[model samples]
Target: MGFDEVIPAPGRAWWSPVDQGAFVLDPGTVLHAGPGTERVAHWLRSTVGAATGLLLAEGRGDHGIELGLDPGLGPEAYRLDVTGQGIRVRGGDPAGVFWGAQTLRQLLGPEAFRRAPVDPGRREWPVPLGTVEDRPRFRWRGLMLDVARHFMPKDGVLRYLDLMAAHKLNVLHLHLTDDQGWRIEIRKYPRLTETGSWRSRTKFGHRASPLWEEKPHGGHYTQDDIREIVAYAAERHITVVPEIDIPGHSQAAIAAYPELGNTDVIDTASLTVWDTWGISPNVLAPTDNTLRFYEGVFEELLELFPSEFVHVGGDECPKEQWRQSPVAQARIKELGLADEDGLQAWFIAHFDKWLSARGRRLIGWDEILEGGLAKGAAVSSWRGYAGGIAAARAGHDVVMCPEQHVYLDHRQAPGEDEPVPIGYVRTLEDVYRFEPVPPELTEPEARHVLGTQANVWTEVMEDPARVDYQVFPRLSAFAEVAWSHLPAPREREFIGFQRRMVAHYARLDALGVAYRPHTGPRPWQRRPGVLGRPLEGPPPNR
Candidate 1:
């Protein structure tokens, strides 16, 4: 069983025989059997193919196969044994066999398929050989792409979707509306896309002044385009949850339909791009017409996206406009509400009831946690983990996307040389070190924590390459955190995992991804040696 003696046979062709007991690993290479012949054969071939490819690339000729399966194997169980004969993956389910194949692929180097001498005791493949009953850790591991701030083209969206699928991520939250642009086409309100989508001015740089350009900058996804994107994501098992910012971030909507505004002022031009980082003044007028308008929009949204959950953005909505408007005050009196927050809550509850009747649940940002959470609504905590904690405590489902750790747009480092502003410095190690479930939660309450997501706001991320630069490495870390539970932040196990990531990066390179390189020490290495003492400040400039 010494690794150095085995030589891989590169030109071997894998074959499966009708007898459910044995398999030809490659031509004459025989692997002693299992019950699921077809499934095992598929696993063996794929693993051998991948491993062979890896070995050939690495200039190593090592090859092997091993099999160990007990009787009464459940549908989920799969056992992979690697030996000199080749790798044999036997599982009651084809999927389990496929996963075992992936594990084997990971063991072999990039040149595995080519004939090469297996490194003997010098390199040992540590394959965990035990019962692993595994499944997805979260129902929704999502990444939100804010298309409205700056519209990303259709092809770019597809590329993002592919990346999500590659990491086994399951949700793509499309933020399709904002004060700057309305991205989804509404046929009933053609102007929503035609006029509201286009902007005359776009602010440039983090601190740059708003550039007033004569050129109209705008684009939107047609209904047909959305249908295609939805179908594409569906094939990859990724749901595209569309978000339409309501009650607030409705400036673009208001521009499209002036009647939806509290003021009859015709001079209201939709913001080209927001200059400020916080809430905007132009919010949806709390009037009967506004409700009817959003109802129509939601009807169109339901037809386009078949996802069970609809995101109505309820974040960063300032109540100044509503508080100052006479019509809003009248509505408040009519509805017997206390203040603008109550009015905002009322608006959200209306959609909650509307979506509920159509067999869909409403999802909103943590801002919805204000006033009161809508019954049966799920909260996406972006401000921090406290919102998710509060929601779970109140018997509500939550997605733990704390900005401190999960905001992908945050600069990975604190150095001013970073591309984006340092919102909250979340290095790849920070992301990898995250634990989705808060430590303070009780076992039963923890069950309410649904999953985690990484938000790419795209305010500073204008170019697709920059997006890739920000997402990868850190995203890989978040992917692991979302899919499985790992040890504590400073555990040596994580350091070991980080070392293994070196190989994973090679695979990413082979896949032609432009991922950021991990250049820092593991989290354990960076722990403060002495408590309550500030570290030396950055050396006084030169």
Candidate 2:
């Protein structure tokens, strides 16, 4: 009866009387799919069959489930009605049908989450009669993975995609390049992956002020691999937004080809894939070569990722190197720019023009606002909400991922035991309480606020298991914040949501999600790379 029973609590839902009866699914049950919902029906057929050992057929039938498109429904919205006679889902679009399928899976039970060995005879799942009308509160429900910090393999990425899709998050922002490594292959620059992907060692900073592992560490995603990744995410109705960090976090690129940097200012060979943390002063110099290099890189990226938005990191870029370079200074005066910040804008605008030509939108960190953001660029406000507020006021679309709220790397709790020992505490409650559209914005201004995201920076994370522990539960809580409308003063609401998680946690367990236990982290959960202590901020990306 109470809506608190739902995770990501559906926009609207209600229970029906048991006398109304329930639909008993069997091998012979037909999954009738309407136009534009065939793919979703197919997925549902496969999913349900796998979970319960029922060979449900996909076809029109008198007594069975139905997936249909409702022309009147809005974007990513769906309505589900269930009765003993049958169950029916009407969606606004293909995507809406997919979400409806997800909701149906939840309704079916935890068994719907996994493909276990079914008994030979067959099994029947009885679904409770109910009605749910749902739609997302925001279009850009997203989750970001900084694979550049610690290269997550292809399967690892896929697993996250499955998890995200299950939670109804639509965007998977891949931070592909950083000072530590460049994870995507650029055919034009083979060395970007060949040389830039490998580091002589990793800095532990445990034994000494700075320690290095003698072991060489490296990995990369080939063009084919990226293609496969794109196709896989597409099947799940998720968009993969690729990031190629420029200017700043260019140590990897500079390591591959020193000419991309200010060789006039510093020794070119000194630039190696950074092993230690901190922003490297090494950055791509404002030269024809640097511009052409990125153009080539994006040329490859454009072919790989077709998402409307592409992230070109413009955050935490130090201007010291640009100020000192004679070439940089001369170029500044040549362009009639006031300072280094303007030069950085030149870099962003170059790509802005390039992506726009390809009919894609440029997404940059809040720093793109320093000199001036390019005309069509969408701003990702990570530093804080003020950047999003500013960008929205300026009529630019903004994504809210303020570190204080949505950064998952931040310790979930305080004291010595919190791993990744960085960032101030940002708990599940903090994330759930965050509103994507800032209060400072007027109604018109608020429209520019697309949505928000939870960032999982893998600076200290080395494997997929740790990623799960850090992301789940909190991610689950944030999903509700992004999808469901909150009643004013949501404290009591959170308590209700927390209760809902008891069932969700069981679902996660059945699906083999190594979520952090309600108690605390296990000993092995803190692997060699991470410890129980807390970390604040990142190792200098300076």
Candidate 3:
């Protein structure tokens, strides 16, 4: 494949023909590492070498692949030059060199993505002579994976990290908690996992569906498991942002400890881990005890995740509970809050200040903007661009992931064949055309647009395969949207992108991704009789 065919399309590239003779990676090929590139050298030796079955011994021999750093390039920019003589990969920093290494692997063919070489005895791996100078359009190219609705084991999460790295995506927002389940262990709150992790049954499809799976479902990552996940992602230059939904989507936590809920408004002790989808009215009580309880949870959480930004879910919270509870009313009156919205904002503000005090920043859903945004909070604008625009203009950072464009759980096509089709139909091309920075923002305001993220909500996705079917192919498009410098949404050259996907499909297959084929889902991939919540009209962007 030529450089033009690379996914997320390189910023600039020049390729030579096969007749010029391909540079072969033989048994004798050595790997040379320069200053500040030890990590990349190790990654090349371990990851690429393991996949290609080459020793790639450490040395400075002639015709060896060299990895080095260039002080002039951007931190995430890299330059690759390959010829019959040898290959040179250089970047401004370690991350750039690592991304360059990813491109090198891509050049070696689909087999380079495998865990082990298909032909163990074969040593020669040829790559065409070419030069690529590339850098990302956005620093925070991310994917938010919701594992609360349906748990993915640690290994699956690792696989996704690898996938994200392959596409030059650098952020993994792990939604660890929600109304349905809690997927992270807190030592201070042992029962969160013991009682809140498992649900008695699960909604088969949408919350409105009549079907139910009458079986237990739950899982949580141990502290060591989380440490491993963080280290694994760090190796690939990816950040794992942990999301702990607060105030709202805390039924699981409340189920673990009834005191965390509004006892006056509801029978908190009688509640169980949520068995269905959609918003839950069982929000946390706006009390000092609730604050202290979550503060303890965050104290342990900060130890596990060291990312600069911590997500406190500030979305879809119901006010009916606070409206009905005298305790909540007293708290609101005591704090001089306007109403329940102000209370929700106050809840988020507490954490924002708490996190800021510990040298970390707070990020939450756009709903956090309703009452009064905290001083040091970022917005994950999921509903649409309006929140993002407002946040940016107000000098707050924003990650545009409007549901109309990047919600992967939404059906890929308009048909019953799509598995548990949810929300709007957002096809692959639609994602490719998604522009993160809105035109309404002035140049200065646009700087607050940190980057873009594609959300994968697992409410209807029961297992990894179903998640794969919904995410991939379209994720490829979203990756380009985040990384590549492209024209306006309507002017993007999707036909060219489709051509590039032809080669990427082979790579996905080699990596064991059960992505929905471009034409449509494979017969086995379809959920025949499952119900879905498909809206009648198209999204505004469409």
Candidate 4:
């Protein structure tokens, strides 16, 4: 295999056996700095120390390790050259350099991911002889964390960020608000968390047999928590994109502030935090007050996340309330809009204008394309690539997260029971075969396809371990799909990629990730309703 030590296979790389020779890292190794690489050096030292319990010394030297800047390499690209004498890594920017360091850790073997002190007999980590010239194929390699459905703590979020960075994934799209809960702290809206972040009980069990987790469930990240998470992600060159879902998933918010909902049609005073799943008819009323309330929320969001695009959830919005509300109908007539879809479009357009004024672009679910798409709105195509193809054709940016192929919440296999079983089966190969830009899009239209990401909706997932089980291995394949450019569907091969996973899994083990094994689920994991059926043909929703 050509330079087999890396995942998201490098673009250009070569490796050869050097007859019992390797770059052995030990306590005596010296880290030489390049401009803007002090942090990089420190990271390397900390990582090495964590794995081997030996701190590496830093100074100017002929070489132990060297980090250099190479402006010509372009952005998010790097070159790692390993020789018998030492190792040298060059990147176009700090992000590129950080990726290289992550790769270097992989090269050092699985033990490199461990935090345990070094063994008495093992004092060094060896990297094979090789050079890797690498860069990502797509700019928006990302993963979505749905903290709204079932809140994940700040620590878990940070851990997942580390894993994303290890795979060189650049974006962390945090689904922070939904009918189930609102997960971000807004100073002006304390009630949003105090009342909305919690639900009386949870709807659990299969569709045929329903049950409830009678205990109250809730959690929210404070402003300070968000600030720390953002900084941590920034240090690893990962951008945390916060999604404060609105319009449809606003039941929680409406529960906190009754005025935010359609009090004219729905009983706002009786609106409790949504206790179940699926689309909620309790959407944000298309009114000035609701608009002003969200603007204040976005003010806090924009300050927290430096991401250029903010996701305003515009999907699964039931029009029952809109169809019954006089205010919504009046807004549609006032704007000369067609129907409920038009009214929803008008609502999104308001935010589009609002966000644009603040130098940010509006991003929302593909449903935003319903009546009319905003001028600069970006679409996250979850239902399928059809929306993405349409959005690209319409000259708008698109992030292809088709539910069929990229939804990590889906069961890994047809018969395997899962902790959080939902959605149709999406195999590792299915994810590996996913290409962000659809074949139907022309070159010009394809330019609008920024890239793609996998989403982990946590309706059934109750803990970090469950999230780990649902997202991994498949996440690994997806990393390659987003970062490495292989041939089209039938032509692309994954055997080598599979081979590399053998070692990568060890790295994950060291990191204490509870990934599912390739052999399939353990016996305890198998159950009737828990095991999802395979998606043989196009899924009904898709």
lDDT of 4 by residue, 361-426 (tens): 999989999988877999999988899999999999999999989988787876435554456778
lDDT of 2 by residue, 91-148 (tens): 8888888898888888777777787644555567777788899999889989999988
Best-fitting candidate, scored by TM-score: 3
TM-score result, candidate 4: 0.96
Clashing pairs in model 3? none
Local distance difference test scores for all models:
0.66, 0.82, 0.90, 0.84
How far in Å is the alpha carbon of 457 misplaced in model 2? 0.6
Candidate number with the higher lDDT (1 or 4):
4
Model 4 lDDT-worst window of ten = 533-542
lDDT of 3 by residue, 157-265 (tens): 9999999999999999999999899999999889999999999999787766777899999999999999999999999999999999998999999999999999998
Q: Indicate which candidate wins on lDDT.
A: 3
Name the candidate, 1 or 3, with the larger lDDT value. Answer: 3
- Looking at candidate 2, the ten consecutive residues that score lowest on lDDT are 204-213
* TM-scores for every predicted model: 0.76, 0.95, 0.97, 0.96
Ranking by TM-score, best first?
A: 3, 4, 2, 1
